[model samples]
Target chain A: MDSMIQINNLKKTYSNGFNALKGININIEKGKFFGLLGPNGAGKTTTIGILTGLVNLTSGNVLIDGYDVIKDYKITRRMIGLSPQEINLDVFFTIKELLTFQGGYFGLSLSESKKRVEKLLYDLGLEDKVNAKARELSGGMKRRVQIAKALVHDPELIILDEPTAGVDIELRHLLWNSLKEMNIKQNKTLLLTTHYIEEAEALCDEVAIIDDGKIIAQGSPKELIKADGESYINITVNKINENILSDYNIDINENIIKITSKNPEKDIPNIINILSESNIAVRNLNVKTASLEDVFLKLTGKNIIDD
Target chain B: MINTPFLTLIYREVLRFIVLYKQTIMPGIISSGLYLVIFGHALGSRIGSINNIDYIHFIIPGLTMMAVINQSYANSSSSIMQAKYLKFIEDYLVAPVSGFELSMSFIIGAIFRGVINGILIILTCWMLTDFNVHNYSLSLFFLIITSCVFGAIGVIIGIISKSWDQVGVFGTFVFMPLSMLGGVFWSVDMLPKGWQFITILNPLYWMINGLRYSMIGISEIPIMFSIIISIIFAIIFTIIASVMFSRGYRIKS
Candidate 1:
């Protein structure tokens, strides 16, 4: 598989001696929807900054489409569109004018820019705001404008840094649908850094969770859950037999039997069979499978919202 | 040939000032008009003429250069400082533009504002009084080069400033004092020898004198000397601004 972004031994030590990135490596393949998950101040923004050339790296290298980010900045920058975490809009101009200027920065002519801007306005549900200044828009509208500006130049790789950080549910759903459409139909590569683990689970093909400037786990959400997450089978019986269930990790409270297993599907039938032979009547049964959130908590030992 | 991205940045800078003309352009013209009324018409009768020219005519170049300097500095510095404060500077930082192109764009936009304001003041003088430019080419050169000098200084201040107070300090303390004592109203020779020596050291004095010579064919210093001084300051400031921008001083981390 051809990688669209390759980060090798990346490190960034800010002027105040804060080590933001500590020689971390990440590789995202072409047309892949990749997620970088971490707590606050875990070098997510710093990594994005280095990739987009906003912040200089203290050491290490980054390549976009096989071109060095610094040595061939012109080529690499043109290939990526960054929707930063901050609103950072020039509030004075209309949305159309702002996006057109963004296109011009990427070398698009006026005619081509107009075409792309109009299309993005329609796609992002911002057609009515074409003539309104950015400051006049609502928070969700401004967020949409940020995305429109990023897509105006038709870049191959789109980096969204907390794009849905403060948005409402309606807008988040709208953005997720739009992003999924682009990744699937347009074959665009997306690198998303988000605090919402469910967002990563729903959208990313693969994910890497970073903490304290180090990546602790990386894989598909299902694979990570299977490797590190635990499932539980809760069964309520009229009567319990402790001797028959001794082979499993069981916790009993009165008439309830809770068995922990890595593979709940294989263990559930065996437990039921053993119960039936022992003349134990099953009144109720519940099976709980692990989610990405469970895996994140198990590895990081902290919730995503924890500072 | 300039690339599209560079031209686009220049267009955006020029458009910003033009869009806010009531605040950016009108203030200079109105202020200069008031100066002509109070100092030129109101006080000209008592002071009479200086150096064989009408008192009103004598102050035209000085007033015009003052407007050019103030507007040029204000446009570039305020534009950049606002971008930094508002966080919109990240747009330019992430764009595919070279440092040279970005610096040149801001300087060129500032020059445009300065020249426009200077020309309007000159035209104002022509309507209100019978002042005609003695050397049009030389007057334009002074307007452009002086703007270049202040515009470059403005970029430097904008980049290094951590707060609005820092941005305003340069205008309030340094620029105002030097401009006031730079012979905008009275000739340097009118003062005593010690004061005359002090006024000549002012860079604004040379700029105003350069424009005065171009417009009225009268200057205390030689015309070539003023031109050389203006060029030297322009080169030094431009080089510094360009180098700072390329190095990403106080901008990139």
Candidate 2:
């Protein structure tokens, strides 16, 4: 499959001598839901900024639909729609006006822009607030307007930078449905960056974990976890007895016992039997597979959701 | 064929101010009126005539030109600065619009506001006092070129200014004093030799003189010189603004 976006050794060094991006490379396949997951200040936004031409790349090239971002900006920019991390919108313009104007910015004619604006307003559930000022809308509504503004041009690829940030659960689900519809039904290629591990796990077909200005891991969520090749069985008992754990490699934290195993199917039942034989009342038993979070922790030695 | 991004940006810029007309237009009109009433009445009698015209008549052109200058400057400075402050300028930056297109859209929007304000002040002068436009075509020429000059200057300021307070400082310390000292209330001949020499160094003086020549066939300097200077200054300010836009000063990361 042809790539919708191909980044070749992209690097960005800020004036303050901070190397925000250090020769990172990525290729997003056409019509695929790709997630770039990272912690804060992990070069996710910088990469997005360079892709959208907000930040200048220090060295290397980025091609969107086979066109260089700098040499062929007009064609490249027209092919990608960006929902930035920040709420960069005119507060005074109405929702409909923002969409229409964004369409026009991409060279859409006035009539065509208006038609697209109407459809996007209805699709995004902003029909009732079409005439409302951007500042008047709630935070979720503002985020929706940003998405509508990005989609008004109908680009081939949509890049969302932290689109669900600060949104409530219901709004997050609503956005997820719309995004899924765009990716699945409409066959639009998506490149999303987020800190939400579950969002990446649930929606993205391929995930890339970037840490400290580098891509530390990349694969499907399940494949990434399976490739880590580690599973754990957690058992909560009424009391911990050191004599019972003498033969097994187990971590005892208060009344909880955690034992790592290569295979959970064989190890979980054995652990449960040992707990039962020890006369320890089993309060809880959980078999944990390696998740994307665990994979991230193994690769970077840091949690994904760190303040 | 699709319309250019420049066209859309211009439409957006003009529409932005029109939607906020009370903030953009009303203050300029009210201030122009106050200047006409207070300054015209207070000094019209004491300073009887300037170069064979009444003080009221002489200052009408100045007041109208002043309004054009301030409005032109304010329109672009506030418009572009607001986009930067709110980070909405990224919309244009990420789009296919060129630097020239972005810069020209702002300059054109500022010219529109300046010309509109000029017309309103001229109409207000005609209705309230005995003011006449001597040469309609020449007046249009001066109004447009002078507005363009200030509009370009505004775009330059807008690109370089980092804060709203910086914009306020420019208006207060730079634009306002320059306009007042540019012979808005009095003629250059009334000043001493050294002051007259210093006043001629101000660009707004030439702009005001050009407008006065257009409105009443009277000026502190030769009409040809004023016209040439205004056109030259317009070109220079436009080049400066265009260069700033091309460099993405304070705009692109």
Off by over 4 Å in 1: none
lDDT of 2 by residue, B11-106 (tens): 887887788889878887788788778777776788688789988888888898888988888888988888888888888888987677778889
TM-score of 1: 0.96
| Residue-level lDDT tens digits of model 1 in A1-307 | 9999999999999999999899899999999999999889889999999888788899999999999999998889889899999898887688899899999888887678989999999988899989999889999999999888789899999999999989999899999999999999999999999988889988999999988888889898889988998898999999977889999999999999999888898999999999999999999999888888888888888898766
Candidate 2 residue-wise lDDT at A203: 92
Write down the C-alpha DockQ for each prediction. Answer: 0.80, 0.66
Give candidate 2 misplaced runs (Cα > 4 Å). Answer: A235-257, A262-285
- Could you give candidate 2's per-residue lDDT for residues A1-307 as a string of tens digits? 9988899998889888998888888988999999998888889999988888788889999999899998898888888899998898887687788788899899898789999999888988889998899889899999999888789899999999999999999989999998999999999999999888889988999988888888878888888887875777788899888787666668889988888876678777777777789788889989787678777788878787883
Residue pairs with backbone atoms closer than 3 Å in model 2 (clashes): none
Model 2 lDDT on a 0 to 1 scale = 0.86
Q: Who wins the DockQ comparison?
A: 1
